[model samples]
Target chain A: MRFYGYFRSSSAYRCRIAFNLKGLAPEVVTVNLRDKAHRDDAFLAMNPQGLVPVLDTGTARLTQSLAIIEWLDETQAGARLLPDDATARAEVRAFAQIIACEVHPLQNLRVLNYIKAHHGQDQDGAGAWCRHWIAEGLAACEAIAAAQDHRGAFAFGDRPGLADICLVPQMFSADRFGLATDAYPRLRAIRAACEALPAFAEAHPARQPDAQ
Target chain B: MRFYGYFRSSSAYRCRIAFNLKGLAPEVVTVNLRDKAHRDDAFLAMNPQGLVPVLDTGTARLTQSLAIIEWLDETQAGARLLPDDATARAEVRAFAQIIACEVHPLQNLRVLNYIKAHHGQDQDGAGAWCRHWIAEGLAACEAIAAAQDHRGAFAFGDRPGLADICLVPQMFSADRFGLATDAYPRLRAIRAACEALPAFAEAHPARQPDAQ
Candidate 1:
C-alpha cells in the first residue's frame, strides 16, 4: 500500500491519523501541494480531483480523505474506526462531516486562492475568511459533542475513532489560521485527548517528513 | 420516523432520493430554510448545526445528508445504497464526496452569503463564484466517470447507488446556477440515467410539498 499526501493538508493529516490508529504502514509519497504537484497530469491521472491524500491499495487508487479513512476502517484489523450500531455510526459520521464538508471546504487552499485572486483579498482578508468558517463550524461541533448523551474521553466514546480523527486535523487547521478555539471547549477537550494518543501525535503535520 | 427537511436543500434532496430508493417513507416535516426556520431554538435543539435534512429515526436524530443516507442503507430493508466490496464501496463514496464535500459546500447558502456580505459580490458575482466551483468540481466528476473501467449507465455500475444519488442533485444545482451540462458528457449521461428512475424523478425539489 502507498499513500500520496502533503504534510500540512488537514485532509492528509486525517488519513495519516487513521493509518496510525489502524497500525498500518503504507509507503508515503509526498505530493507537494505547495509546488502544485497535485495539478500535474501524472497526479491528475491518479486522482482527477487533484487532491490528497490518495491511498493506493496496490490494486486501486483511492481519493478523498474520508473515503480513504473509511476504506481503512473497513479493511484494516487493528482498530474499529466507526461504531457497530447504525444510529451511533450516523451520529459519529455527522460530526465528522461537519468538519469535512461544512468547515474544511470553505477554507480550502483553492477557495482562499480564489478569494485572493478574484475578490481582491490579501493575506489578512483570507485569514479572516478561514477563521470565520472554522469558528462557526467548530462551535456547531462543540454543541453536538456537549449534547451527546454518552460523551467520553473522545468525541463519541472512550476510544478515539472517526470523529476524533477528523476533529484533531481541523483543530490543527484552526490553530494554523490563528482561530482561537476557546469557544469550542468540548472540541478542545476532545483534541487534547486525541493529541495525547501516539497515533494522533505521530500524524501531526510538524512530525511528518515533508513538513517545511 | 420523522424527517426534517426543506424542499430546495440539495442535502435534503439527496436524502429524499435515498429514502425513495430504500422504499422507506419517514414522516416529513418541512423546515423552511428561506425564513431562517432552521435557526430557531427548537430546530437547533434537534440539530445544533442548524442545517435542514435532519432525520429523526425514533432512536436518534441524524444530521449530515450522507450520514443519514448511510444509516438508512444500513437499517432499512431495501436496495443497498453501498456496494458490498470494500474497494467498490470506497470508489462509490469517493465519487459522492466529490460532490458532497467539494462541490455542494462551496455553493452552500451560508458560504455564498458570507462571500456576498464580506467580499462585495453582487448577485452576478455570487453566480460566477457558484459557476466556477460547480464547473470545476463536475469536471473532476466527469473525468473520473469517463476514466472508470467497465462503466455502466450510472456513475459506478448498473445500479444507481450513492454516487448517482449525489450526482443528480449536484446536476440540479448546476442547472439552477445556469451552468451548461453539455461540457460534461459522462456526468450528463449518468444524470440522464438516474433521472429516468421513479426514485430519482419523485425526489426532485419541484415535487416536494414545500417547494414554492
Candidate 2:
C-alpha cells in the first residue's frame, strides 16, 4: 500500500490518524501542495481530482479522505472506525461529516485562495473567514457531543474512531488559524482526549516527514 | 419515521431517492427553507445544523444525506446502495464525495447567500459561481465515470447504487444552473439511465409534495 499526502491538509491528517489506528503502515509519498506539485501530470494521473491523501492499494487508487478512511475500516480487522449498530454508525459518520463537509471545505486552502482572489480578501480576511466557518461547525459538533447519550472520551464512545480521526485534524486547523475554541468545551475535551492517543499525536502535521 | 425536507433541497432529494430504493415509507414533513422555517426553534431542536432532510427515526435524528443513505443501506437490507466489495465501495464513495463535498457545498443556497452578502455578488455572479464549481466537479466525475472499469449504465457496474444516487441529484443541480453537460458523455448516459428509473423520477425536486 502507498499513500500520497501533504503535511498540513486536514483530509490527509484524517487518513493518517485512521492509518495509525488501523495499524497499517503504507509507503508514504508527499505531494507538496504549497508548490502546486499536485497539479503535475504524474499526480493528476493518480487522482484526477488532485486532492491529497490518495491511497494506492496496488490494485486501485483511492481519493477522498473520508472514503479512504471508510475503506480502511472495512478492509482491516482490528479497531473498528464505526460502531456495530447502524444508528450508532450514522451518528459517528454525521459527526465526522460536520467537520469533513461543513468545516473543512469552507476553510480549505483552495477555498481561502479563491476568497482572496475572487472576493478581494486579504490574509487577515481569509483568517477571519476560516474562523467563522470553523467555529460554526465546531459549535454544532460540540452540541452533538454534548447531547444526552453521545458524550464520551471520544466523539461517540471510548474508542477514538472515525469522528476522532476527523476532529483532531480540524482542531489542528482551528489552532493554525488562531481561532478561539473556548466556545466548545466538549469539543475541546474531545480534542484533548484524542491528542493524548498516539495515533492522533503521531498524525499531527508537524510530525509528518514532509513538514517544513 | 419522519423526514423534514424541502422540495428543492438536493440533499433531501438524495434521501428521497434512497428511501424510494429501500421501500421505506417514512412520513414526509415539509420544512420551507425559503421562508426560514428550518431556523425555527422547533426545527432547530430537531437538527441544530438547521439543514433540510433531518430524518427522525422515532429514536434518533439523522442529518447529512450521504450518512442517511448509508444508514438506510445498512439498516434496511432489500437494496444495496453500496457495492459488496470494499474497493468497489471506496470507488463509489469517492465518486459521490466528489459531488457531495466538492460540488454541492460550493453551490448550496447558504454558500451562494454568503457570496451575495459578503462578496457583493449578485444573482448572476452567484449563478456563474455555481456553474464554475459544478463544471469543475462534474468534469472530474465524468473522468471517473469514463475510466476503464467504472463505466456502465450507472456510475459503477450495471447497478444504480450510491454513486448513481449522488450523481443524479448533482445532474439536477447542474441543469438548474444551466451548465452545459455535453462534455460528459458517460455522465450524461448514466444520468439518462438513472432518470428512467422510478426511484430517480419520483425523487425529482419538481415531484416533491412541497415543491412550488
Candidate 3:
C-alpha cells in the first residue's frame, strides 16, 4: 500500500493516524498540494477530486478520509477500529463525520482560497473562519463525548478508535489556528490521551516526510 | 425506523430515497431547517449536530446521511446499495464522499451565513459562491462518472446505488443554483435516469411533507 498526503492536511493526518493505528504502514507518496500538484495530470490520474489523504491499496486508490478509514476498518483484522454492531458503528461514524464532513471541509485549502479571493480574508481572517467552524463543531462533539458513560479516557470507549482518530487531528488544527478549546473538556481530555499514543504522535504533520 | 428530514436538504433526500428503494418507508418526520428548527431542543435530542436527516433506528439516532444510508444498507437487507466486493464498495464510497464531504458542506446554509456576514456577500453573492463550488465539484464528479464503467445507467453501473443517490440530490442543488450543467452531460444523464424513477422522484425535496 501507498499513501498520498500533505503534512498540514488534517484529513491526511487522520489517514496517517489510521494507517499507524491499524499497524499497517504504507509507503508515503507525497502529493504537494501547495504547489498545485494534486491538480497536475499525474495526481488527477490517481484521484479526480485532487484531494489529499488518498490511500493507494496498490490495486485501488481510496478518496475521502472517512472512506479510507472505513475501508481500512472493514478490510483489516486486528484491533477493529469500528464496533461490529450496526448502532455502535453509526454512533462512531456520526462523530467522525461531524469532524470530517462538517468541520474540516470549511477549513480546507480550497475554501481558504475562496475566502482569500472572493471574501478578501487575510491569513488571520482565514484563521478566524477556521476557528469559528471548529468551535461550533467541537461544541457539538463535546456534547456527544460528554454524553458517553462507557468511555474510558477515550472519545467512545477505552480504546482510541475512529472518533478519536478524527478528533485529535482537528484539535491539532485548532491549536494551530490559536482557537480556544477550553470549552470542550472531553475533547481536551480525549485528545490528550490520543496524543500520548505512539500512533497519533508519529502521524503528526510535523513528523511527516513532506513537512516544510 | 423513523427519519426526520427537511425537503430541500440533499443529504436528507439521499436517505429518503434510500429508504424508499429498500422498501423500509421508515416513519418520516420533518425538520424545517429554514426556521432554525433543527437546532431546537427536540431535534438536538436526536442529533447533537442539530443537522437534518437524522434516522432513528429505534435503538439510536443516526446522523450524517452517508452513515445513516450505509447503516440501512448493511442492516436492512433490501436493495444492496453497496457492492459485495471491497474494492467496489470503496469506489462507491469515494464517489459519494466527493459530494457529501467535499461539495455539500461548502454549500450548506451555515457556510452561506458566514459568507454573508464575514465576506460581505449578500444573498446573491452567497448564492454565487454556492454555484461556484457546485460547478467545481460537479466538474470533478463528471470526470469521475465518465471515467468509470458501472453496470447500470447510474453513477457507477446500471444500479442506483449510493453514489447515484448522492449524485442526484447534488445535481438538484446544482440546478437550484442556476448552474449551467449542460457542460456535464454524463452527470445530467445519470441524474435524469435516477430522477425518472419513482423512488428518486418521490424523494425530491419539494415533494417532502415539510416542503412548505
Candidate 4:
C-alpha cells in the first residue's frame, strides 16, 4: 500500500497517525499540493476530487479523510478506532466531525483563497479566519470530551482511535494559527497522552519527510 | 424514531430523503434555524453542536448528518444505502462528501452569516457567495457523476444510496439559491431520476409540513 499525501494536509496527517498507531508501514509518496500536482490528470484519475491523503491498497483507492479512516478501522485489527457499542460509535463520529466537517473545512486553503479573492481578506485575514473556526470547534470539542465519563485518557477511551487521530491534528493546526488550546483542558491532556506514544509521534507533521 | 430537522436544511433534507427511501417513518420535529432554536439547551442536550437533523432512536441520539445516515444504513437492511463492495462504498462515500463536506458546508447559513457580518457582503453578495461555491462543487459533482458508469441509474450503481441522497439535497439547494443546474448534465439526469421518486418528492422542502 502507498499513501499519497502532503505533510501539511490535515486529512493526510490523520491517516499518517492512524498508520503509525496501527503499526502498519506503508510507503509514503508526497504529493505537492503547493505546486498544483494534485490537480494533474494522473492524480485526478486516481482521485477525481484531486484531494490529498489517498490510501491505495492493492484493490481500493480511497478518498475523503473520514471515509478513509473508516475503511482503515474496518480492515485493521490492532486498534479499533471506533467502539463496539453503536451509541459510542455515534459519539466518536460526532466528535470527529467537530473537526472534519466544522473546523477543518472552513480553514482549508481553498476556502481561504475564495475568501481572499472575493471577500478581500488578506493573509493575516486568512490566518485569523483559520484561528477563529478552530477555536470555536475546539470549544465545542472540549465540552464533548468532558461529557464522556467513558472517555479514557484519550478522547473515547484509554486507546486513541479515530476521534483522537482527528483531534490531535486539529489541535496541531490550532497551534499553527496561534490559537490557544489552553481552554480545552481535556483536549490538551489527551493530546499529551497521544503524543507520548511513538505511533502518534512518528506521524506528526514535523516528523514527516515532506515537512517544510 | 424522531427526527429533528428543518425544511430547507440541506443536511436534514438528505436525512429525510434517506429515511423515506429506507422505508422508515420517523416523527418530524422541526428545529427552526432561522429562529436560532438549535442553539437552545434542549436541542444541545441531543447535539452539543446545536445543529439540526438529530435522529433519536430512543436508545441513542445521533448527530453529524453523514454519521447519522451511515448509522441508519448499518442498522437497516431495506435499501442498502451504501455499496456492498468496499471500492464501491468508498466511491459512494466520496461522492457524498463532495456535497456534505465540500459544497454544502461552504453555503451553510452560518458561513453565509459570517460573510454577511464580517465581509459586509449584502444580499446579492451573499447570494453570489452561495452561487459561486455551489457552482464549483456542483461542477465537481458533475465531473464525478459523468466519470462513473453505474449498473443502475444512480450515482453509485443503480440504487439510491448516500451519493444520491447528497446529490438531490444539493440540487434542491442549488434551485433554492436560483443557481443554474444546466451545466451539470449527468447531475441533472440523476436529480430527475431522484425527483421522480415519491420518497424524494415527499421529502422536498416545499412539500414538508413546516415549509414556508
Query: What are the models' TM-scores?
Result: 0.99, 0.97, 0.97, 0.96
lDDT of 1 by residue, A121-197 (tens): 99999999999999888989999898867758899889999999999989988999999998888888889999999
Candidate fnat values, all: 0.88, 0.67, 0.82, 0.54
Whose lDDT is greatest here? 1
* Model 1 TM-score (2 dp): 0.99
Winner by DockQ: 1
Worst 10 residues of 2 chain A by lDDT: A143-152
Cα lDDT for residue A48, model 2?
84
* Ranking 3 against 4 by lDDT, winner: 3
- Model 1 chain A: weakest 10-residue lDDT segment is A144-153
lDDT of 2 by residue, B1-212 (tens): 99989888988999999999898889999999899999899988888788888988889999999999999898886788998899989988999898988888888888888878878789988898889888988888988889857446888888788998889899899999999899999999999999999988998999887889
Alpha carbon lDDT of each predicted model: 0.93, 0.88, 0.88, 0.86
Candidate 1 differs from the real structure by a C-alpha RMSD in angstroms, to one decimal, of 0.9
Give lDDT tens digits, candidate 3, residues A10-119. Answer: 98998888888889988988888889989898888888788887888978888888888889988986668998888888889889989988999888889999889988
The C-alpha RMSD in Å for every predicted model, in order, reads: 0.9, 1.3, 1.2, 1.5
Number of the candidate with higher lDDT, 1 or 2 = 1
Q: Model 4, A1-212: lDDT tens per residue?
A: 89999999999999988887777888989999989899999998888778897889888788888888778777776777888877788878888877888889888878888899999999888888888788878888998888888747999888999899999999999988889878999999999999999988888889988888
Off by over 4 Å in 4: none
Candidate 3 per-residue lDDT, tens place, B7-74, comes to 99889989989988898887888787888999899888877888988887787888899889889988
Q: Which structure is stronger by TM-score: 1 or 4? A: 1
